[model samples]
Target: MKKSLELLEFLGEPVSRDMKETLAHGSRQFRMSVHMTRVPSINNVVLYSHWHEELELLFLAKGSALFHIGQEKVTVRSGEVVFIPPNLLHSASRLDQEEIVFYAVLVHFNFLSSLENDQIQQQYILPIFMQNRRYPKLITREMDEELHIYPLLEEIRDAYQQESLGYELLVKAKLLEILYRLQKCAIHADADLDIGESRNSNSLQAKKVLAYVQQNYGKRITLADMAQHVNLSPAYFCRFMKKQFDLSPMDFLNEYRIAEAISLMETTDKKMTEIAELTGFCNVNRFTETFKNFYGCTPAYYRKAIRNHAGDGQHAVRCDTDLKSY
Candidate 1:
């Protein structure tokens, strides 16, 4: 069963002040807490999706992770870093190892709002967010080879740890360096890729449509109804989604429903009937049937299995669609 949109919204709120403070005391400034994580098995990294209004960067320092960024899923190896846009849905998990070590930086846009020069606004933000430019929006091209910036990342970490004499200024300087480096590489590398002709229009549309679905998942959404949200014809939306994700709109909705159901099952004790209705499914019987079909087990069994293994650590799961757990 899926959680109601209202409940999902509540669950997605940012970390509590107390929790944030707990993470802030150490060398890591909780601007966004940085962690070094290791899991005996990656299964604990259960697949779930959620979007945040803050930008996040994940750098694989010593292991590999399978990451789903929008409609694409790929393995990111050590030395590679991925930058995620604010409000984009993504999920990831380690592919192997008794443990994997990586560095993560979560940057709230407001933290850098003062640095938003006219040039940045003109070139990056407007074209992608406002004009809806249908492109990958590269942040770090040839990321596998960009090890020189590792020093800047380390500096940010150290400045937070030391907090001695103008540390805040130093941190900001390092952040600016990181951003400038990414922007410079993106511009040059994308030029070589010549993204004009080969860009995936359908995937771009799918992203927009998925955002709409997530915002309205608790409501009665249909194919024709969602198509109107993107101003694309119903038939076109259906065809485009199928080509882009290999699933029809309805199939995607079902996957989303199941994903939400999994989140609720793990986090709440709502009854199956209630979850079914909240997720937009009409009956528990139908919900169970669909859940079984997709996961090869009943929801109850799945929940119990997860409970038994909940303490192992955070392991990412296969992202059914883009909607993720916050």
Candidate 2:
């Protein structure tokens, strides 16, 4: 338990909440960074959630892993990949013993000052992330064939190892190439996914409730509030939530609250007491107990572990290593 807490402290700290810092491996001026990390065991990580301010591209280079994005969970094995957007709570866990190997790149959409044009940013990036409310967030590869991201991964690996002059420039170019390929892949996969699927009208009420909760999680949200949002009575909404989401309304509310708490914990430097109140918990004791129940550690310890594990560099923000497989 202590070991897991330590790992979570390092990897699960939210990136956006507190004193936002740019990841150091890449040019801070560019709005993204890339790195490779290794862990001795999965328990050395924490099962917490966080989001980024830039688009995230995670390609499984080896082994298998599970990703939790909102209420949706998906598995990605070697040769598989996933896309996560800025400011969505998410986390990953290694699936098996062979150390999980993957290449990840965080891209700040309007990163370059030269490329901050509104039209280009909206055209190239907004379309991918803005329309995410209707679907469970995060994009995963659905095809059986492996995405040839490994070659690009290899190039990045080489540049890191060789460290010849201009290596960073080379890495930046390679990263862009990977993002372009991923964007193309996302458009293709999305088109295919839509063909066989019809909208789930039965879940319309649940969807509305989810959107409302996400928007208002930091405030005191009650069952009455959510029920009214979906035009259902509180009594029926309780049953409906159970039938649809496998959780009671209160449980769902707690999940959202804790999820928000986890994100704030990682990204911001706010004290645990303040975070507890900010995330809608009326009291610190109640908040601490609930947080530990969901995340398997006390909030203070969790924060401490993160500070301890992350190294002395600016960009060395660690990845989640302590979580059980989702």
Candidate 3:
């Protein structure tokens, strides 16, 4: 917890919540990126929910979290890794007073394929990306005794940070190594999983909440509107959201909106006021205050710093050690 809080304080706050489903984690060529996500327990802040097309591995280095993955709550403790398949709604936060820190690595499967189809590709790789087999949901420290993939994940983090020439080659090789271990893990652990179980109605409602926010985030949405979309009374809806995400409906919406605003600031030359309106904030002042509240700094300064570090391939600015895997 000391190291986790230090990293959070180093960055002033967690990396601007990239809660959009469509944002690519890294460049298209590499299609792999790592984010040191730290979720503070204060201010009611949590990692907001979103889905993407890239496979995700979250190595929980310190503290534990009650993770909302695909409508179910999973308690991931220290030294465990979370394997989230593409297109699953997932979010995380500290279950108690402690802060949570983890490394989120996203990689598109196509980038990892061989130049030509091979037997290894067919037998070991194709089933995962093609959805024929489900990815394992969790990898515990105890289960990794034989595989040692946790240490490999730490190696991946070190290799990615080196940035030496041809380091991508090492990263790719390690990712494939992890995949092989994951295959073995599936046979051992997920064999008893009920793949065809019916999803809860609450999960369906959660999906609806995500869908509504994604489509309507740029509009003036309210608590009543959010509750109505899920067809629950305002009071019940708030409780449902709290139980599921530990956040109010408007807080979730605001996190989503702020994520969008950060995207716009990075990708566009839009003015602050325009970006505010584009992100569904009623006024620029409100947008600025909320942005500052989330990140302890003004939007203008954040944008200026971003521009200052342009073309360096930074998703967010940090020192190399700030991205510790364990």
Clashes of each: 9, 12, 0
lDDT of 1 by residue, 33-98 (tens): 333333334233422344555566666666676776555666776766666665555656556654
Q: What is the lDDT for 204 in model 1?
A: 50
In terms of TM-score, how similar is model 1 to the real structure? 0.61
RMSD of 3: 8.4
lDDT, candidate 3, 1-326, per-residue tens: 21322233222222212334644466767778766765443322345576676888888887787777775677888888888877566776556646566887778877777788998777767666654566567787788787787788887777776666787899899999899877775643234344523333565677788778878899989999999999999999999888766679988888778877876776789999999999999999999999987767889998886776554644342221234223
Alpha-carbon shift of residue 100 in model 3 (angstroms): 2.5
Compute the lDDT of residue 314 as modeled in candidate 3. 40
- What TM-score, over all chains together, does every model reach? 0.61, 0.50, 0.61
Report residue 269 deviation for candidate 2 (angstroms): 22
Can you tell me which runs of candidate 2 are displaced by over 4 Å?
1-11, 15-27, 37-47, 70-72, 93-101, 112-147, 157-162, 183-326
Rate residue 54 of model 2 by lDDT: 66
Local distance difference test, candidate 3: 0.71
Number of residue pairs clashing in candidate 2, backbone atoms closer than 3 angstroms, sequence gap of 3 or more or interchain? 12
Question: Which of the two candidates, 1 or 2, achieves a greater lDDT against the reference?
Answer: 2
Model 2 over residues 1-326: C-alpha lDDT tens digits?
11222233244443433212223324554455554444333232323344556666666766776776544577777776566666454556656656665666666655532345576455544654453223223334444234455567667656644567896688677866665655544542355455313323433454566667667777888889989888889999998777655579987778768767755776788888888888889888989998787667887876666556455432223353311111
Best by TM-score: 3
